[model samples]
Target: YKSGQKCVKVIVPENASIDVYGSGWVCNSGFKKSSTSCVPMTPQEIQKQKELEKALAAEIQRRRAQGVSGDDCETEYKTNAEVCVEITGGDLDCNESYGGDYYRDCDATLRYEVSTDYSGGAYLDVDVECSIEIEYKGRETYSTQTDSSSQDESHSLYAHGSDSETMNFNFSFSSYKEITSVKISSAQCEIDSVDLY
Candidate 1:
């Protein structure tokens, strides 16, 4: 029965009957009840909980120093090749019987160069593109037939094409951690080296 409630019913069993009403129960000598729950914590238990909290705080601080954040950095590579071939035929071919050696042939080597730069820890994405422009004897040639026999290829950060082509790419990372280094595969182009700021 509660402190202020009434016990309105009573029945005694033939075999056993025990009834205690209007009485308060006390806890053991060294135990105490708080609200509706029991709690027992020795000094060791309390010390262990404090130690766990301190270790958690230290781990969080370490992560912050490692530059964990919502920002990200990205990198990409691009390549291109421009080839020009100049063939000089010094005679108007009239007949094979014309005994005059007046034909000259000259060839110039083509060069391909690739360069890259990055913004340290500030890069959200990257874009790469390559273009080829052919100039013969100080004249711009827009015809693709001029270099039809030439073959070019690229093996970059994202391998795209061959034979003097343009490729565009974009990349994203998880955090704004500074870029450490960039590596390029062995290729047949002049690499100007990557720069980071």
Candidate 2:
């Protein structure tokens, strides 16, 4: 009885019963009181909690072994490495753009010159075609260097078509070891396609 009220009937909750002295409620055998309710803490629940704690401890140990820790940790091991082998060049000596070897005319003194012209467009696709006459493998063959170049003219309204620039390309044939002589002729550049944006 409280607040000046007289005791009438006792209200007992589930998983709970009257206390030992028969004054108030108490949680039953394996249950615990939580605020206004009784919660079960059976043997199975205790076993599951123990297993979870064991698994958590094992996981923390594994993580700590794998270079992960809170405040007290250090690197487990160290390593030193060195390069054993190194490989180098087969790049073109003349123009890095041009590749492969061809027998050419020695009249140009082993050098080839070409000029490129850009048209009135936002972009220009040009081809620097050169006649290659190289004496390779005891035979003379004539071929054309159809290497291409693309130029951007985005900085201006129209590209200057008259702006001509001559680029020189050198030639050498180290593979063909017969009666030797390589002479690259003068190359010519022409616009393949013009783009305007």
Candidate 3:
């Protein structure tokens, strides 16, 4: 029962699924799935994963300092090629409204911005998107700063249904090469001035 609810640690066999509610096994997210058995990621893949974990941990700390719960709870992974974040602790009254029950839920990451570099030449030459779950009230707006007096708004997304929803914004931005500071604002909350290495 504890394992099913993800409330306890239980050993699971190989070639199994952790995302499965009661499949009696658990494993990392990045794996090449075949018809029967599961294949682990290569050495290069493991190194990539470690780097990702460090990046994610840094972001999680920043978000948590902003009073966002679930830094230790909510997580995201791939269901295929899409980035999906896990959502938990919804208002029991609003479960039907959210279309989920028990275990974990996956919300597909929205590719909000995917274009050229921002003006002023200080911004990173890459693309970014809103990877957080918007399950609360108000809206999530995407903006970038090129200069002190100006801001860029490319996308505006709204969170419907529950009010006290918890999620993380993918704020580790810029070129992914040398990110100094990151900031993201949603209708319900704002994570400001997060540091990135």
- Candidate 3 deviant stretches above 4 angstroms: 1-20, 23-31, 68-197
The number of the candidate with the highest TM-score is 3
Worst 10 residues of 2 by lDDT: 82-91
lDDT of 2 at 192: 29
lDDT of 1 at 196: 23
**TM-score on alpha carbons, each prediction:** 0.19, 0.23, 0.28
Summarize candidate 2's per-residue lDDT along 13-71 as a digit string, tens digits.
89999853455565675665454567776698456545644664675577558763221
Instruction: Give the candidate order by descending lDDT.
Output: 2, 3, 1
Per-residue lDDT of 1-197 in model 1, one digit per residue for the tens?
A: 33357644443323223322323222232222232222343477456545644664574466458864211222333222221111111101111111212111112222332322322342212222222222122113233221111333333321222122222112221122212221111112222232221
TM-score of 2: 0.23
Cand. 2 Cα-lDDT: 0.34
- Residue 175 lDDT, candidate 2, scale 0-100: 37
Residue pairs that clash (backbone atoms under 3 angstroms), model 1: 152-163
* Candidate 3 local lDDT, residue 40: 71
If candidate 2 were superposed on the true structure by all CA atoms, what would the RMSD be?
Answer: 39.8
lDDT for model 1: 0.26
Q: Model 2 clash pairs?
A: 103-133, 103-134, 104-133, 104-134, 104-183, 105-183, 106-183
